[model samples]
Target: MQVTIDKNSGYCFGVEFAIQMAEDELAHGGMLYCLGDIVHNRMEVERLNQKGLRVIDREQLELLHDCKVLIRAHGEPPETYALALRNNLELIDASCPVVLKLQNRVKHAFDLSQRQDGQIVIYGQPGHAEVAGLAGQTGNRALIVMTEADLDQVDFARPVTLFSQTTKSTAGFYKMKALMEARIAAAGGTLDSFDANDSICRQVSNREPQLAIFAAQHDVVLFVSGRKSSNGKALFSVVNAVNPRSYFIENEGELQDEWFAGAATVGICGATSTPLWLMRQVAEGVESMGELV
Candidate 1:
């Protein structure tokens, strides 16, 4: 059996930066707490946990005082920073540059729209840390639309400035934008649609086309990613769409020998949040199964 691995299948720039920062902090030999999972992958988080990187939530933050807490790649709102300040907790902000830029843009757009009596509209999953951070910038004035159906919540007469989560599907974002435009048109109100920022990271957008091509080269494909990762879902969709023999797995333990049956050529790929080491393990496991056969 032959096996191939995707060149682009590994930690993205954002995840890479966050992990490196955490590792650097761990080297200093201090208790480092992360506001959330450094990334979506459980293995990576566990690995970091073993290295003195602690993952905590809002509730944990309230109890701890005078400790170092790192913000994950998904940036937090200003309120989180305020909390850190109040608690005297040293902060290591590892917000992805792309997400940081989006946060700034959200703030700017909200400020601009506020002057004109308009509301900022975000096309992303509500309650997501990124969306909540963006919405919090506007003092909770931002409205989240996860689907076209969510458009009904928007006031069609008000001008809407739209932004997207860094990992959302481009097609979905555009579809929601079109729906918002149509709704305003029907309402006969002055709808000024400001520039729609395609904040979907390049790491994800570029991977789909590459995965499609890579999948074509193999007889079977294995896609590994965390179920909660948005990029994982998006990239897996592309792999399965292009290669009917593709199998999705969350980790090496999920690999099944049946997938390798009668297959001579196999390929392994994963989302940006996936660790390269995990993919390597999956590939090795698949090869071990082939050897036994």
Candidate 2:
């Protein structure tokens, strides 16, 4: 049996930057409070926790004072800063540059829409942290649409500016864009009248096609990812679509021997939120399983 790990799978630049900030703070020996899970991956979170990074919630944030709070790559709204200020807390902002730019763009569009009676439409998971941040820029008035059906909530009779979460699928974003455009056109609008931003990160957008091709080359594919990773679920769908013998597992314990019974080559891959060491750990498990096969 031959076992290989997808070279392209692991933490993207933003997540890497966030985790590195947490590590650096923890090494310096201070009370480091990460606003949320530093990354979606539990293994990486646990690793950081063991190294003295404490994850805190918004409610807990309000009660704390005079400590450093690290904002993860999922940027927070202006309200978070206000709250931090009231409590005299210092914010170690590690917000992704991509997300920060998107927030500013959304705020600007929202400001313009308010005057012209337009709407700010965001294509993302409704309650997602990143989406919440984007919406906060609009004073929480941006219409959140996770699917084409959610587009009905928008008033196409008025101007609409559309933006997307940084980690969402590029194809999915464009598909939603097309559907929204058609809806607006039917309501007597044109492409020139609507504003659409393809804001999905290039690093993530490029991986979908790469993963599909990688899955097709292997007899069996293992998709290693944390359960909370949206990109993991999206990229895994690409793999499953290209190869029927694909499995999603968080770690070695979830790997089943049946997945490799007749397979000569196994491919392992993971999401951008996944740590490289975790993928290497899965590769080691695959190596052991190959010996059994």
Candidate 3:
């Protein structure tokens, strides 16, 4: 059996930066509190937790004071900063530059929308950390839509400005844009009154075509990612579509010997948030399975 790992797979720059920041802080021999899971991958989180990184939620953050808290790649809303100030907590912000820029754009657009009596709409997973951060930019007034049914909340008669979560699939964002355009027409509104921005990060969108090619090249593909990762789901969809033999797993332990039956070549790939070491471990597992098969 021939096993290979996709060179394009693994942590995007934003996630790599955040994890590095966490590790650098931990190296100083001090207790560090993280606002959430440093990354979507549970194995990576567990590894950091062993290094004295404590993951806390919003409620926990509210109750703590006079300590250092590390914000993950997913940026926090204005409210979080306000709360941190009130509690005298030192914030070690590691927010992704892309997310920060999106937040700024959303805030600016929201201000403009107010003058025209327009609504801010977000194409994102409802209640997601990054979505919450983006919604916070609009003062929690942005209508979050994932499916066609979620569009019911929008007022089609009014002017609408739409933005997508930075990590969302490119196809999904365009579909949402088309849906909004149709809704505007149905409400007797012109396209000029609606604005849709494809805010998905280039790092993610660019990977789809590359990953599709990678998936097709292998007889069997192992997609490693945390099930909770948004981009993991998005990218895996592309892989599964290209190669029906693809299997999504979080770690090496999830590998099945039966999956390699008669397979001459195997490929390993993962999401932007996936760690490289994890992919290497998966590759090793696949190689070991070759002997058994």
Candidate 4:
């Protein structure tokens, strides 16, 4: 049996930077309060928690004062900064540059939309951290849509500007765009009044094709990613589409021996938030199964 890990599977630059910042802060021998999970993976979060990282919710953040808080890669809304000021809290901002730029763009779009009576629409999970941050830029006026049903909230007759979450699948974004275009036409609105931006991160979009190729090359594919990771769900769909033998697991412990039955080659891959070490661990587990095969 052969076990291989995809070279393309691991943390994106933004996630890597945030984790590095957290580790650097933790190295100074103090408790670092993170606004949320530094990354979606529980194993990695637990590992960091052992190093004095404490994940806190928004309610908890409001109650704390005059302490250092680390902003995860997902970023935060303007109100979080306002609250920090009120509480005299020091924020170690580790927001991804991509997300920050998107927020700026959304804010600018929102201002323009207000003048034309337009709507700001986002293709993302409604309550996701990144979506919340993006919505904050528009003063929470942006319409969040995950499926055709969510599009019901959108006024197709009005001028609409659409932006996608950075971690969302490229196909999903384009699908939403198409749906919006169809709706606009049905409403007798010209496409000129519609603006759709494919704002997904290049690092993430590029991975789809790479992952498709990787998945096809393996006999059995094990996709390791945290269940809550948006990128994980998107990428796993791609892998599973290419290779029906694909299995999504958070860790090696979830691996089943039945999955390895008659599998000569096994491929291990993960989402952008996934750590390479976790993939390596999964690879070792596959190798152990190889002996039994």
Model 3: lDDT to the true structure: 0.94
Candidate 3: list runs displaced more than 4 Å: 291-293
lDDT of predicted model 4: 0.95
Tell me the tens digit of each residue's lDDT in model 3 across 107-200.
9999999999999999999888999999999899999999999999999999999999998999999988998899999999899999889899
lDDT of 2 by residue, 1-293 (tens): 78888999898998999988888878889789989888889888898888889999989999999999999998999999999999999998999998998899999999998999999999888788899899999999999998877988988888889998888888789999999989988999877769999999889999999999999999999999999888888889899999999999998888888788878888999999988899889889888765544
TM-score of every prediction relative to native: 0.95, 0.97, 0.99, 0.99
Q: Which candidate tops lDDT? A: 4
> Per-residue lDDT tens digits of candidate 4, residues 134-206?
9999999999999999999999999999999999999999999999999999999999999999999999999
- List candidate 2 segments past 4 Å from native: 291-293
- lDDT tens digits, residues 6-105, model 1? 9889988888998999999899997999998888888888999999998898999988899999998889999899898889999998889998888999
The candidate with the higher lDDT, 3 or 4, is 4
Residue 286, model 1: lDDT of 82
> Between candidates 1 and 4, which one is better according to TM-score?
4
Q: What is the lDDT of residue 207 in candidate 3?
A: 99
- Shift in Å, residue 258, candidate 4: 0.9
RMSD in Å for all candidates: 1.7, 1.2, 0.8, 0.7
Which residue pairs show collisions in model 3? Answer: none
